[model samples]
Target: MFSCLKHKVGEVLLPGDEFSFQPEDTISLTDTVKPEKVICGPGLRRSGDRLLVSKSGVLRTKQPNMFWVDSQQKRYVPAKGETVIGIVTVKSGDVFKVDCGGSEQASLSYLAFEGATKRNRPNVQVGDLVFSQFVIANKDMEPELVCVDSSGRANGMGVFGGGGLLFRVSLGLIRRLLAPQSPLRAELQQLFPHELVIGMNGRLWVKASSVQQTLIIANLLESCENMTAEQRRQLFRRAAQGAL
Candidate 1:
């Protein structure tokens, strides 16, 4: 029962001891006298008169559902329509390869660069950070990414420069730090006092008042991983409110 809540794979379930099933949820069950009934990864809960099961499984108690465990390996799975920040790593013919912190590299075409015209395509060099959306994840699981905005414009989608510092952190920490309600996020906003945060799956780009302020923000973001979700949210709120 205790192991299930921790999201560990291969945890065994006993009969009558209700366990939360799905991906990430707490397990609580009434101890049953019999041992024959047991299942894994299926939603189970008791109603007043009968046990209820959901085809989609249980609701994840974890704040962010972005994380998932598959085949006993922990990996970051990017969903379609999700906005992600990535860095350009290499260029090929008309496409640029980007590092999205996933197993396969994502591709952004030359035509997608801001201000690309029939005669003039903006030269986007390596190391430029771009905010993009997952356009396609083919059968092979390779992601095709794009950056065109709703109005069919590519402005505000490329090459972040100045006013901030960039740092690499673990993927898990990045997800926690980016939760909209995270306290750490709010605190970071206040401490640096600027707009426009671009968070990659593993890297962060922030704008600050000064270099010193940027360093402070980086340190704070790094420390947020060990904090609880609620605690992080509070800290972020305080930081955003200028308490940091």
Candidate 2:
């Protein structure tokens, strides 16, 4: 099978755009044609032999021919193995209910933490934020959270995001910030020194040098989510100059 991989990365694509498919539009007798196998990711659909974009955003592709539309969305869908920042709401007998901004509240076992037992319980209070991964997430079932990985290692996964600001943003922005080669991250770093925790569920935690700087950083980041590279660079440079 074959698929179209000719478009440049970070190309903005709107709804109804033909993202990738077998080039039935072009046929050459001398050229061999192969049946294409394209995985229609989010914001895309397959109609007959064609792939159609169903969301408004830039198109993104991974190696080995995986494609998806990166659209700005605030809703969170629980998915297994994805770490998220959640707020504790209820402390049950053993499990704590957390609101991870998903469709439903997730459950976190007190023993999910590393080196935690009934006698060695981790101190967690209501309204506190917990950075944990989804251990079980299915559409038909409530999601479950774990503070440690399958190997019983914390791997920097735990609670305690003291003295920081938490806010929400589009899911697309979070993905862009976490991207390995995103130019935005570099430009942002040049602006100031700050720490950021991005949750896949459209939530983020930020801590900067001071309150003013933190607010500036947060506003700047929110404004840059939908901008192009040149636009983001301009914004970041202006912020660095205290124009924010």
Candidate 3:
């Protein structure tokens, strides 16, 4: 049965829910008879042309047929190339062990920083917040972090907090914030002149002009994890008016 979707958009889906493809509705190309494509995102799996929901959450879709479940989760699973906010937990001879809310502590190399070398190493200490990207991550191996990009540039991937506030949000919201052309960013930008470090690991660092403003920003964002887009817009508008 490759022609039936169990749940519509915005419906909360449970694990084991199955969706099938509808050939007539999905295939409209007259030039060639191509089978309808179903792109299964996170929380979904494909087994023999059957779409299986693997998480309990609302199902969402984007333009051009991308589907994913919007699950509220706090735990983080390390993935390569995902930038995250990490706390330095241990400093080894050559690497720093960082707690990034994952199954295991991630490792950051001492030489990962820009302009760092044997003669001049970055002065990193335990308990400091580091905004790093995963360079090596796998299910079977320990995760490794780096502060620089492919060109050896730090690119805002280094020490994260300097007297700022660090907080946690659901991993799904973090992904929503990092999404390209996200409306949340636009709304937040209009609220305050602040700096935000969004980590894939559910940690966020925010800095505003003053302590009160910073707290307001932090609380506002944390509250957005469960709000709809319209709700967030209304809250942001009211908060901005109140702040100013």
Candidate 4:
């Protein structure tokens, strides 16, 4: 089953692409046999005993049997455990309605933040940006966001401060930026020092030493979404020379 699916990794697959699980190889009764399992991520679904592709994108896999499709999508469908950048749209009694670039606004409770309590709520206001993770996301229910992890620590999730510029990019670009040993991130580090916050939902916040430098980073990121590797290298070289 894994062999049938692993062969298509990194290939562009369209909707309706399906892979059937192959029959297990026969072994002696005395031999130890472990059950195999595959986890399907975004853009892939399981139907009966086959793995089905639900979107158009490149197939990608992670270690220990996890697979997903890397696709360029503007609309975000909330999935549990994915971190996202959200704007507080409405603040009610004890919850804030946040727009996470998803189909609907996700609810964020005041107690979701670290050290928050009934008398001590996190200072969140309307129009503020928040870096949070989805604790409850499903098609049948309203999504919920949290600023703390299971151990009740912030873990880098919280409200954002001023001075950074937030912008949008393709979901595929976000994935690449967050990938291990990302070439784009490495090249950018060589040019200048900057701070970047990437969200799985395509929202990015970037800040540099100056406003001009910040804009330069933002423009380069937006333009490189569809560029080839060589093209991006040449562009980066020109930017480095201009900065000197």
Candidate 5:
């Protein structure tokens, strides 16, 4: 068995593997093994007697690779049933425009707001934070968000005022943190007393006691990927207790 030390072909060295190259000797893996046999890296070719490698990062064989990171700051991906927090951007008759951190804005109907059909539609003005879900995302990836409940009831959903902080963050960081089952959620419940979080792929809206506390929560969410599970729990606990 040949052991590849590194991903590069030239860096690969076997126990007793030996090959000779003359003044202008060009040797390629294809000469000895079939193209299918060659693996790791990309763009393998034979030029004269020398094997040339292309800079393109493609491997002939299927190999586990790292996930792709977006060049932009961390953002959130709209999941089918994901519960998201958003801010009202516009109100037009029965519908409102919301910024969900994507190229296309989201649409929220007045019926989705709490008490829309009741006595009178609560004034959900611009900059009001709302907790909603991804109801529909078209084939073009345009999302239509909603705040209505399963029975089409509007409760525990709508614009949040007071005791909340809003800010922007990379979408990548949001996915790293904020799990439904994570201790952070419970800890936050105790910290803010009454908190609402809206995570857009590019931004975040949080409501907490103080700006300092909100910043701590944001830092914890951003560092979730680097902290251990135990550490994360501890961090959440401390933040809840106002230690962080």
Candidate 6:
């Protein structure tokens, strides 16, 4: 059953694609059988004894039984523990409403920040960009965002200062960019020195030595989503040659 799904990894699967688990052909009375468990992430769900694809995209898997789909989704879906870049839209009482490119705005508490207290609050204001993680997120309930970790440290999550440019990209591209030792990020770093903040909700913030350089990087990233790896390499080569 595990091998059935494992073999399909990296293949394009559409909605309604299903896989069923079956018992082994032979079992020995003296041998102990360990149950195999598989974890389904976004785009895959379990129904009865079968696994079903809920989205149309390429199947992806992580070691030790984790599976999901990498899709070209423009809209963001809030998920618990996902770090996202949100724009503060309203400040109401103790909670701030943040737009995370989702169906509804997520609520961020003033006390969610590091070192924040009733007497001394974090200097949050409307129109500020916050890098926060979702503490509570589900389809039936409103999403909640927090800037601090369980240890009460910001851990790189907090309000963004001025000067960086924020832009949108496909969610699939965002996943690729965030992958371990990502080739796209590696090539970009080779081009120039820059600061990049990648949000799971398809938002990216980039800053370079000059406004022109920042725009150049942003455009390159936005354009490469549909290009093949070789095509991206060719474009990077042109950029390295000062072709821009």
Assess every candidate by TM-score: 0.61, 0.83, 0.85, 0.91, 0.55, 0.96
Name the best candidate (by lDDT).
6
User: Any residue pairs clashing in model 2, and if so which?
Assistant: none
Stretches of candidate 4 off by over 4 Å are 24-35
Model 1, CA-based lDDT:
0.60
Q: lDDT scores for all predictions?
A: 0.60, 0.84, 0.86, 0.92, 0.58, 0.93
lDDT by residue for model 4 (82-150), tens: 999999999999999999999999999999999999999799989999999999999999999999999
Q: How many pairs in model 4 have backbone atoms within 3 A of each other, for residues 3 or more apart or on separate chains, i.e. clashes?
A: 0
lDDT of candidate 2 at residue 82, scale 0 to 100: 93
Tens-digit lDDT track of model 2 for 89-124: 999899999999998999999999999988999999
Tens-digit lDDT string for candidate 3 (34-109): 5566677778898875688999998888766678888988889898889999999998999999999999998898
Better of 2 and 6 by lDDT: 6
Which candidate, 4 or 6, would have the higher lDDT against the true structure? Answer: 6
The CA lDDT at 108 in model 3 is 90
Candidate 6 local lDDT, 1-244, one digit each (tens): 6989999999999999999999998987897888999999889989999999999988888888998887888999999999999999999999999999989999999999999999998898899999999999999999999999999999999999589899999988998999999999899999989999999999999999999999989999999999999999999999888898
Error of 6 at 108 (Å): 0.6
Give the range of the ten consecutive residues with the poorest summed lDDT in model 1. 65-74
**Regions more than 4 Å wrong, model 6:** none
The 10 consecutive residues of candidate 2 with the worst lDDT sum are 1-10
- In the order shown, the candidates' Cα RMSDs to the true structure are 9.9, 3.7, 3.3, 2.1, 11.0, 1.2
